[model samples]
Target chain A: MAKRSFLIPGVDKRLLIKDSLKAMPDFTRRRFIAGGASLGALTLLTGCDVVDSSSAETLLAQVSKFNDAVQAFIFNPDALAPTFPESAITKPFPFNAYYDLDDAPDIDGKDWKLEVRGLVDNKKSWTLDELYKLPQVNQITRHICVEGWSAIGSWTGTPLRDFLKLIGADTRAKYVWFQCADKDGYNSPLDMRSALHPQTQMTFKYASEILPRAYGFPMKIRVPTKLGFKNPKYVVSMEVTNDYKGGYWEDQGYNSFSGS
Target chain B: MASLTVTDEQVGVTPAKVIQPVWVRVMHWINALAMILMILSGWQIYNASPLFGFRFPREYALGGWLGGGLLWHFAAMWLLMINGLAYLVTGFATGRFRKKLLPITPSGVLHDVRAALTFKLGHDDLTVYNYVQRLLYAGIIVVGVLIVLSGLGMWKPVQLYYLVMLFGDYPTARYVHFFCMAAICAFLVIHVLLALLVPKSLRAMIIGR
Candidate 1:
């Protein structure tokens, strides 16, 4: 058996002799004063009712200037959020909401196609199977909600950027619009910066299961960096354009640029 | 030791005239505690969304802390607002406003900016405030007000009536609230760093100069 030894700072026994020689009156008095001051401050915090209005107005004015300065400071052409490893994901996510799938044309794989149109030289439609054949990207990210609940899950899909590249997305295009099927009028605008986020993919599988109807079955969109509302579900068709047409939430007054 | 001529009531040095009046001190601590609680509860709220791909859905459940966190947060918020208002009143009535928190001129701000860029601080004569501190303190107050207004804009859109148009609507107000909070977090990072950089300046607030 091994014996363990640890270092500890032991109190010196000579403190009693030192204390006897020191000015005990001053020491005790100072301690008492300090204790009293702490009590007084605490009392002031709980009992006092004395906030000055002038300070509020002055502080308010100073704060407004600061807000302007911040707005001026944030001028950048391009920036992006990072993607995380799939291993960090949570599995078997509970389905909360789904949208725009019922109106999807129930054509067979050969006939079913996603149309990419508006503001692009090469407009084309790709079949769902064709989309699945493309290079895939998987990401694990937390989905934040406005109602204040969050879920972490693994999403597997092809990046929207890749699809846009395949269609030769016009250089002037400012927004990518998703026109979905279930027809509860689901659509959203994805700006350039967010459209190219590495984690911003069109998701198919939520966990290991193919998406359920309650969770945009078959396929859906996922925008990791923004709020969950930005990730429109039951995605059917996509349109890339420079003009900002109102989407479902945009019409409801959600921010058009909800980048994290 | 030989103070025969000196009276016990010798008033040569008045204890450093209380620069931070009782009201100011009360408001400071209340605001501090309230802000901290808000952040913690806000996190529990944020936990549901984790805005930037961070989530701890089971944290509160695992730790048994979510409910208490929310209660503390809302309760402190009320205290924060009341104390903040009280401080505002005291500042105007006591005329302690101009005495401390002197106005910073553009040139003074410019010099402070340079000092901040160079990581120098607390040279009171040369630099009024390291630019970052002035900017952060100033920004925090603005963000705080925005949060309150935007929160109202969301919760009582009908009452604030005019805010709906300014911030867009409920969802937009939510965005503003979230964005302002993000700004606060950014300020907090810098604030903690500055606190570490200059200990005495941080102490001045607590010890009343």
Candidate 2:
């Protein structure tokens, strides 16, 4: 006698159903499928239509946006990333960038001015000295890379929230975009909540020394809560805007709001 | 429930009751799918830096690239967490934990180990889980919790400092998470092997017989 397959057929149909449900734009499907939906129910919802790869990608992107909204909604403005003791800082911190250390841009600090653009009352650029004059603070925090390694480093700079306030930027803006001085025009954007986090800094120094060329000579935004890539180095300009200006990696399908 | 019990009068075998419920089987397969995707995508992500000397092969890894792997990892992470949580809650609330998994003793575990090592373990009765099965199930539950906590620590080490501290540090937490994943993979190997050897067990899990 031939052996009978029991659950395999059902499992395959269920997977197809799940795929169709995921492709649907309606949020009600989630609620309806809360306790798990049957194949008949899924077919009824999607009309048994096949979702192509492009449609699947679009659905996935929508899901990612939904995740971002949920994360932003739950984020606490006052909550701080953990700060470590000075001794805990990783020595000889590994240099990470899209390019080699030798390729790091040699910016002329004396001639350079931090450009302020977009929705800000004051459009005045700041010299390195002027940025240094802002109330400075220090933090020993971990820099978690997207790739699996992590390192602790001591960073010092002006609080980004204070700087935004001083610049008379609209705090209600959706994103604070960074334009890097790197050769590739590498950049990233931060949501309002992460932008205003206490540890988010317009960093100017590392381990009591002036920010080295390898670590963004003029300035870097130290956002501890986000993955390392979100902390765009070699930052030359900043823009406060409601428009969705995607980042370098973000445009390549990496999550825009990469907050932990 | 009574109809599910089976006895062989001619062979003089005792009656065996159905062990897996429909919900248990559903949770089992969902968890299996989530774990498989997570492990595969996690390997793809690990290949980005590699704590060890070598990296996982592209063909063997899921998601194709680092960005794609991250998307898969984060997506499946929610599935694993939510499904695992529901399984835990249901297991405890429905008394499945107390009735089927708990009350394990050192002596009972020792006896089961001896029985297993000596090849004296029997599968004639499928109603009750053996001491070893019970212990392994409990151990996997503990490891699952550790994996989630360590993953959280790695995900938001700064925000979830206490979880990071639980495993000594961030690096340590990463190592813990990796090893837990390895442990689960090992369990899966043994589980599938045993299921093949005892085909009825597979049928029970699938059909809740």
Candidate 3:
């Protein structure tokens, strides 16, 4: 019929007078049905303030885990992430972290030790000078972040595969878990295949200069293939193990194998 | 029971032709569902680092946040890819693609464009796809394929380096994916309007009567 006000049966009639402003039911019914379903599904996924074992959060987590396995299977270690020319380097490379810049862990180079543990023949920790001396190489590669931004930065360091070999790390292990000095204990697990990538490095310098405090000083594992978060910074200890220890963001629903 | 027993052909009555076969109808509904999930979740993912300036409203987004958006996107991606592959394979194997969307000519499209603009386009014959429908249906197929490729390129720039290279780079591939989504949304508006304008076509898609 025509645009006009209508009443609900009884209890809800007074509360819904604003509904009279809407278009004809024939026009708006389908839109409402579709929007309602979407809103319903959104609430289903997020409305539960408490995430338990049997929740949709767990279901999505399981899918993320499945994605990790798919990524591992599809990962070709020989296929390298494209490297850029020196000129292509993103000037003043963006500094990204869960916390603000001034709060980045401040550590003295004189006191820091790269602790090595688990499934490695060499349990000895290495000093910053010792890591700096390991046959160095440089690469300008794109750093892709999960937030959908990317930057190219030149990093100089020894390949993680070579360093792992030098440290006598067991290659059979599934992951190289890095524990960082960030106040929130920000950490990440590096998959073995990615850890062995030719370009993956335990970086010591940025743009031929000593790594700065703002850019994870002491060291940052530069993984070009994976999303930025997978590249843990200010790493203090590493354990080569079969265990899948959840990470800072990974535990909060981010996919563990966030590589591209 | 007698009505069911008596054949339409034997009784000198024309049979109701099935314009969309059972498989096509099944796959069409599935594709429609998957497309909605993908587009909604993708909007949220794009909002994370939008290429252009404006953002899709949060209420319109499917997932609650970035992480949730990605989960929904990846989940729907698998469904879309599988269903899409099945559509292509069966369509090609059965010559359905050739029958429905072939012989598309520039002149025919222009004529249809003129007819559509002036609101003179006819939908009396549901079985014979008009030139506009053929062109749109065919063009959307190509767009669908490119969007998936670009999505893959963005997803695995390293493992699929060669694929990403075809689109120039990661950010460029993101642009292609975004434009493809835009094209699909455009098509959806027209497609839905036509279905509404010709309600019998919508009935055929649903009940296949």
TM-score to true structure, per model: 0.44, 0.85, 0.84
Model 2, runs deviating above 4 Å: A1-56, B1-16
Worst ten in a row by lDDT for model 2 chain A: A41-50
Model 3's CAPRI class?
incorrect
Question: For every model in order, what is the number of clashing pairs?
Answer: 18, 0, 1
lDDT order, best first, reads 3, 2, 1
Q: What are the Cα lDDT values of the candidates?
A: 0.59, 0.83, 0.85
Which candidate tops lDDT?
Answer: 3
Candidate order by decreasing DockQ: 2, 3, 1
Second chain TM-score for model 3: 0.92
Which candidate number has the best TM-score? Answer: 2
Pitting candidate 1 against candidate 3, the one with the higher DockQ is 3
RMSDs, each prediction?
22.0, 7.0, 12.0
lDDT of 1 by residue, B89-192 (tens): 77667765444444646787788678768766454531244444455565677788887777655533433436645786445676788888778778778777
Worst 10 residues of 1 chain A by lDDT: A4-13
TM-score of chain A of each: 0.62, 0.80, 0.77
Weakest ten-residue segment in model 3 chain B by summed lDDT: B1-10
